[model samples]
Target: MILLQLLFSFLQVGLLSIGGGYAALPIIQNQVVDLNHWLTAREFGDIVTISQMTPGPIAINAATFVGTKIAGVPGAIVSTLGTVLPSFVIVLFLAWFYYKYRQLKSIKAVLKGLRPAVTALIAASGVSMIIACFWPDGAVSLNNLNIESFILFAGAFIVLRKFKAGPIKVMIACGLVALIISYI
Candidate 1:
């Protein structure tokens, strides 16, 4: 039953979450955290972190993790299958459709309009994660700010933007810095 629930919930996430993994964050959070109460907010955040660090697409990784946490290996398989099924079918259909209608002004306009919506979804997810990182208690207040996290965030942003450092390098540096900070 739990495996079925995981599959069904992630199916909705895969079907409805347009744009990509970043954009799917909110929908996945809503399903697992808000609606189903399978994972707490903190657990969801941890899953997101783990998903990002893993090799696969964030959505698939998240589904696998959530399923495993909720049930077991079978749950992981079901959830992952549910998550990718819609995307696989949709992509195949879109590829053929786009190939056939590549010159259509309506298709072009639709794709153009979707860009802003996708950007908004990604931004919303980012803001939620930022709030979660800065305020672990879920309250937005100066007293609740995590200075270490803020500093790490600022340093990472600067490294990526100013130095054009690769993300893996920045992640490694941040991990080292965090490890040092923990002992200090």
Candidate 2:
């Protein structure tokens, strides 16, 4: 039953989250945190951080991690498949039609329109995740806040905004700062 739920939830996210892995974060968070009670919002955010630090898509990483937490190795396999299947199906179909309709103006126009819709979905997903982070239970309060996280978030934002350093450099600097802060 748990495996089935994991598969269905991930599959739904995989189907709808068209932009990229970050675009899927809110759906995963909603299912894992609010619907299933599989993990807390902080844990979900931790998963996102770890997913970003690691290789592969965030959605797949999340599926494996969350599934394992819920129902072990089999759950991971099922969840991972669920997350990938939609993309596989959609891409396969698109590839088939794209070669034949490559010059069709109507198809081209539809594709152009799709780009903005996908972007909007991605943006909406980001807003939802931000809301989840700040207001887990629909009420915003500083008491529920994680101070270290907010500090790190602020510092990272400032660094990224002011210095214009490459992302890798910023990640490295943040990692070192986190290590130093951990000991203090």
Candidate 3:
């Protein structure tokens, strides 16, 4: 029963979350925080933080974490599958259809239009994550702020933008900085 619930909950999120992991954050928050009461908003934010540090999409990591929290390994497995299944099915169908309609100019035009929309959605997700990092409750006040995180975020942004260093290097540098700061 718990596994089924986990599966369905994630399936709903997976089907509707068009943009990606960050896009799914609000849905996950509602499910885990408001509906099931499985975890608090702070815990969800922590999960998002850990998810960003790992490989793969944020949504999958979130489903695994929340599932494990709810019903252990089995729940994690179910939730992960549920989250991926829709994407698998949709992509397979679209690939086949696109191959069949390869010569259709209208189809190509539609896809071209879709590219920008998808990019926009992904960009929106990034903005959402940035907002979450600074203001988890949607409030931007200096009193309940994390200065270390702000410093790390600003430094990372500058390094990535100016130096054009690869993401792995940036992550490693950020991790080292965080580790050193933690001991201070």
Cα lDDT for residue 131, model 1?
A: 95
State which candidate, 1 or 2, has the greater lDDT. Answer: 1
Identify the leading candidate in terms of TM-score. 3
Error of 3 at 140 (Å): 15
For candidate 2, the per-residue lDDT at 130 reads 67
Q: If scored against the real structure, what TM-score would every candidate get? A: 0.62, 0.58, 0.64
Candidate 2 residue lDDT tens string, 1-184: 9889999989987998877866788888887899988999889989999986699998899899989998999999999999999999989998999988978999989889889999998899877776675565676677876566567667877988998878888878878987999999
Candidate 2's clash total is 0
Candidate 1: where is the Cα deviation over 4 Å? 1-79
lDDT of 1 by residue, 6-64 (tens): 98998998998887767899999999999999889999999888886678877898888
Each prediction's Cα RMSD? 5.3, 6.9, 4.9
Give the lDDT of residue 153 in candidate 3. 93
| Local distance difference test scores for all models | 0.90, 0.85, 0.86
Candidate number with the higher TM-score (1 or 3): 3
lDDT of 1 at 5: 91
| lDDT at position 173, candidate 3 | 95
> Rank order by lDDT, top first?
1, 3, 2
**C-alpha lDDT (0 to 100) for residue 113 of candidate 1:** 91
Q: Which digits, one per residue and each the tens of the lDDT, describe model 3 over residues 1-184?
A: 9998888888887888896756888887887788888888889889988987789888898889999989999999999998999889998998999999967999889989999999997898788787778775668788856677788999999999999989989989988999998899
